[model samples]
Target: MSAEQLPALVVVAPLVAAPVALLARRALPAWMVATAACGFSFVAALALAVQVTSGGAVSYALGSWPPPWGIEYRVDVLSAFVLVLVSGVATVVAPFAWASASAELERERLYLFYALYCLCVAGLLGMTATGDAFNLFVFMEIASLSSYVLIALGRDRRALLSAYQYLVLGTIGATFYVIGIGLLYLMTGTLNMADMAARLSDISSTRPVLAALAFITVGVSLKLALFPLHLWLPNAYTYAPSAVTAFLAATGTKVSVYVLLRFYFGVFGTRIVLEELPMSQILLALSVVAIVTASLVALWQADLKRLLAYSSIAQIGYITLGISMASREGLTAAVVHLFNHGITKGALFLLVGGVALRAGHAGFDRLQGLARTMPLTSLGIVIAGLSLIGTPGTAGFVSKWYLVLGAIEAGRWWLAAFIVATSLIAVAYIWRFVEAAYLAPLGGATPRAGEAPAAMLVPAWILVAASVWFGFDTSYSVQGAARAAALLLQ
Candidate 1:
């Protein structure tokens, strides 16, 4: 692939593959096309990341037109890092879906599943890669709409209601975001993010600009499921097909978080968002509540997926809490945790998919003595669970350590204490699973299905192994996040 064409190809490959997969009209062929498309995006993203690392930033104008007149695709340190994250997770999750989807979806709709899968990946990558603010909203909708349908494809009928709830909330979020973009365009007269940033400086303190910030913050917060706006997450995760849940859990909200970061520091600049206004304090307050409340809620969930879904909220809180600090250390923790949590949660959900495939559900009863049959999957979950709890020598601990360092550097010792204290709540929830799978007797709650096919287990373990590897080697994730954070501060 040409260096000049890599950015477009990264998004277009999956966009084109979606149609091809849909026309295939069969599960296997469609999945092959979708997986190949994700593979292409992954490779392209890695190449872009390497280029960005060696050089400064990569910028490509669409249709041979220059920026401020035509749409641009830009990869900077932050966006390039996120591009690698979304594409890599898509590559891993696509392979796992073949076995998981076959067990959970109706045969007739499997082709459609792959189609939406490609569309979702394309949308997420577009959101990260684009240089235009309005274009990011368009991609956000593309990802959200496809995700709604994908979540509805579960064999369980409740998937319909979950999708509907998400549809309603998602529509509202889209409306708010687009409205904010409109306000910014009216004030700045440019949709290009870089141009807008330059233009917004003169009018940064104007009422409309402040309003735009508020609109975008609330809108993106809803999209990312921060705190009370997260009402739709538990049910959606609980009922969605396992593969879809894994994909979205790893990529979707993280992309929204990226957009929020882009707007806060990249477009508006920290002087306005963090110091001039109360945005940082607001984010900090909400993040603390999200982490504490969500962890407690997760502790009581009977449905395994819902429990992990709540755990996702807690993790997102950690990421956002880091962002609220706006220090170099804080932003580094925020960006790196995006990758760490994405892989850790993705691995957990994938291993849980094995349980869902064998037991036909992930309820507490179905998980009893799961280790007796699905030993590999069970053990994988425990490893990932330790990561989730920020145990030493795991990816989660790396993120938590940075967060505590950031807090202490900012002189928020109470925040540091809270960070450590809340982790105990996570330990409680993770131990519930350990008690069920390892200590509980093998009962009738579990099915006779021996284990998930290798097609599923192997992909899940890849992410599990990645969590351990990254914990020891901080060269890629930590360094990338640090550069991204430094770039934003610049």
Candidate 2:
């Protein structure tokens, strides 16, 4: 295959490797297959990122068929950015699965875990890379199905309930998305996004087009876990195996957000979605409520994992709020926050997992005395938590800063105040963890256990270190986000 074809290959490699992983079964051979597939996929994503930065945009028609007639795999700066996030997390999480799988999943099902992971990763990659509307739905299903399986494999019996709930809600979301695609296809007779965009420019004011936009917006909002529709997120994240939580926290909703951006900006165009309709107002209202309500709920969670799950819903609100502002600065805030928050939450969840591995649980009551025993891991958690609060000189600060700027640019001083107020709410929840970990005495009265294995600690540190590293390095995120925002505007 040519170098230009690597985007398709990057997605296909894991897809092709999944069956190999399944064939390897639960033996050490299965681990080898996972490592190989994840490793190769990681490299392919890096290569695609490099190629996109150097070459502008990359597009490959499936089976040598041209656009509007055949499926296309396309990579631009934004898609490449998400590809890196998805594949990179999968690569790091694989080694983590080695230690974590036995603790939380059936030994015989370990190979199946990696196999489904690869499928999920491939589906996300496919969703981000495809230029066809129908293909996006197909890939969305691939990812969502694998996600349900991954959630169901958690050690806790409650994970089954969580998985079933997510399955039902996620299936409804995907079906809605498909129906929307069907509406678009019926109206335009073409599945290609660029071709649809060209055709949509001609008759976007029509009733069919407006209905199609409404269907797609609601569908994507559900998929992305927007407020009032995010009931499935907390239980799913809280009960899922630690490795699954880390991977999904870093990638799943982010990909859904990318799909939202792709459809809103790339397919339907800005004027129709932002100006003609009341989407921005609806998004703004929900985002504000999500930020306030979710953060408040996070404060009350007794379980650390559940707390973080609620925090994720709040963080998603920040991302969507930026979108609601509909300015270049606002979109930049959203895009940069997507990457920044991923690293922060990934680090935090990994630390939570490590805590679970050593202490046998991750409840705040269970984690007392950890600060003395698992010093480094606890510190990592603290650092990530600080970032979550948008503490100065962290990655989270940069995104939140841009968001505040966007609010000011939109001349909404109320939004700026609300942003700060919600951050104070964040401080409350983060302090709840900090106080429990550092100040509270041991609840069990037993001596603290040793740290988690090096496999888990190292990966957690990598993400934590990245959170700190990216805070000071604005050139990469700033330029990339700006380019992506500009591209969306165009």
Candidate 3:
């Protein structure tokens, strides 16, 4: 009820609703409970964002215990921005999930899907809000476990394999993260991030602290699917249920990236990681490799979901590229792209899901002539795809513009050129779908499928429209990212 409690409530609303939804024991009722909870969390996140933006950081100590000893829910510009993005996506995805889940899942499993969805949302929100290191790992597991189950609910048997692979890798990542935090706790005797930062300042050059940095970087990179570590993502996205893919593809990795930012800038400081250890060069090399390799792989994919899966990897490369620059503008670019790419990719995946609903498959072969049959869905895909290519007057362009500027500001002209050049690969992959839908003729024997149900179409288009709206009006995405960047750099 109090403004001070908004941060905790943002996570608690969905956490409490998960079990309540499960107890409902019916799909419709469970869905209503989940949706209501997500909506409430979204509102709380928005209010928290407003408070942080207007009044600066808001920290709430759990159980009235003072931190270093107590877990803290800290809302600053960066975390608040991410909180809004995660909760906002969950709110929109909740309505769209009803139609897609009912069609893809068994009646008995539908309620379970709703319950896991709430858990995932709660976990993501908690991860963003928490200011304690161990608390973050706890929330990360909550989200990761729920996500594994959601992916396994896919119709194909491969879904089980994909989920298993993700579970294995995700657990490894979490374990490494805990080990890193344990080392930090040993050095600082504190699990609170702010306190850890203060204590680490004097001992950052020590071997244990450096090892903690390595462990945390690799651990978070694995979770965020940073290139050579991205083996679990494509299959998981490819085999997962459409709604699950849309939700995870949009919010999951973005939150991981936020964690990386929190540790890199907020706790460890850029001087230690970026300068003292050559981390920027290492990140730059990996990011370039990810962009070039993943985009090329995406161009050759036969399945639409897999192509987008690879595309997500390439887009993440762009975000990391910005981070590697280690400039205020570069971090701002990374933050902006994190939000923009989430909306663009979310829209694209949701549209693909709509097509899957009507056509039963998202492969290029199945989607041939989709423009003629599922006109609205195809149109939404094209628009979102154009954004992916960083076309002017789209959300993606705003981020890309700042990325190029960041490279140029950092005196990396070649990097700027490479960024533009890699975008051509995006064009090629996007054109694959365009040609399949528009150029390929419809088979005479194929049954004509109409557009997706309004429930799905509306949410998909909402993100598509957001892509364009944010493109033209840069106030929220761009300016908020600038403020967030300033806060992180502090």
Candidate 4:
């Protein structure tokens, strides 16, 4: 296929594979199909990004129809960058999911697991690849419904409650979002995002448009689990299947964040969103609170998954905080952290899943002197944890440095100080794991758990190593973020 077909193929591969995986009715074959589809999409996304970077935005009109009248799939620099992140995560997580699901799920249900995984991946990729407002909402539901079922498939009973909570709140968020889209369609008479942007430019200050903005903000906020609306996240992350937990934790909220960014900067002009409205200030306030409270709460959690879940909330705060800055540096920080944090959290959860696999649980009690037994998994967790804590020479530090620079650029020195202070809270929580695994002594009679199988460990370590590799080489994460920021701000 030519480069122009990449956008369609990026979302279609996994989407089409879902039914094929389901019909296979076997675990290994289903997993192979799922993994292959994800791999194909990731390659397509990379090619799409390269094409966009070298040439310009690529637009694929459905059925050869063009513009506001027909559905359009557009790939610009920002969307291309995000497509790479989302599909890339799905690609890496696919093999990890295969190993993880085989361990945690029943033999009969394996096909179902792979099918839902493909659907979820397709939904997220579509969310980034689509250029129409209503189309994004549709893809959002596809992803959300698949994820809710995926979370419910967990080995833990609490997974049901977690999935239910996410479903109810997720439904509310979707309703609000579609309503906002309805308003946009009502006002603009166009569903295509580029057309909407062009049409809304003149009447952006009107009440309907402003209300649409408000609705979109609250809706996207809930989807992204921004602060107070984040009740569903911790439990969902805590109880889901290990692979589901890692995949959702890595990509779910990040895609929501991309949607939020797309709506705020891409659809609504920055002037109206930032100047006429108080979203920047509101986002700033909520982000700071999320960082502080989630970090402190994380410090007290006994379950490794729960601790990382809260850390995700705090990490998301940093992302939104960067978005709230409304400057080039701030936007770059937000975008970079979005990618970096996704990798860091993905590695952490995958390793914790390994702990749960061998130890029967991932609670603090289960992990005492874990380093003595599950050496590779323990070390991987600690390294990723350091990235979480923004230690020097790690991807987390790259994000932190930009966050501080953004704060300084905005002349919010106190906010800069607050960012660092909150990172210390991260250090404290990450230390909880360190103390449990490395520093604590194990009872003499305790059985050795050995290490996770190489399949799981290798996938987890790839992300762990990336968290460090990105720290040293700013070429991809930082430069991609810079270009995306320029595109958004343009």
**For candidate 4, lDDT tens digit of each residue in 1-490?**
8878888899999999999999999999999999999999989999998899889899999778887788899998888888888888888888888778898999999999999999999999999999998989999999999999999998889999999999999999989999999998899999999899999999999999999998988888899999999999999999999989999998899999999999999999799999998999999999999999999999999898999999999999999999999899999999999999999999999999888888766889888888888889989998999999999999999999999999999999999999999999999998888898889998343238588888888889999999999999999889889998999999
Give the true-structure RMSD of model 3. Answer: 0.9
Q: What TM-score, computed on C-alpha atoms, does each candidate reach?
A: 0.99, 0.98, 0.99, 0.99
**Full-model lDDT, candidate 3:** 0.94
Off by over 4 Å in 1: none
**lDDT per prediction?**
0.94, 0.89, 0.94, 0.92
Runs in model 2 deviating more than 4 A are 445-447
Clashing pairs in 4: none
What TM-score does structure 1 among the candidates reach?
Answer: 0.99
Q: Mark the 10 consecutive residues where model 4 has the least summed lDDT.
A: 442-451
Q: Between the candidate structures 1 and 4, which one is better when assessed by lDDT?
A: 1
Model 3 over residues 1-490: C-alpha lDDT tens digits? Answer: 9999998999999999999999999999999999999999989989988898899999999998989899999999999999989998898889999999999999997999999999999999999999999999999999999999999999999999999999999999999999999999999999999999999999999999999999999999999999999999999999999999999999999999999999999899977998799999999999999999999999999999999999999999999999998888899999999999999999999999988887776888887787898889989999999999999999999999999999999888999999999999999999999898888898552227688999999999999999999999999999999999998888
Error of 2 at 425 (Å): 1.1
lDDT of 1 by residue, 1-490 (tens): 6997888899999999999999999999999999999999999999999999999888999998899889999999899999999999999999999998988888898999999999999999999999999889889999999999999987889999999999999999989999999999999999999999999989899999999999999899999999979999988988999999998999899999999999999999998998899999999999999999999999999988999999999999999999999999999999999999999999999999988888888999988898898889899999999999999989999999999999999999999999999999999999999999899999788866887899999999999999988889989999999999999999
Q: Model 1 residue 422 lDDT?
A: 98
lDDT for model 2 comes to 0.89
Error at 59, model 4, angstroms: 0.8
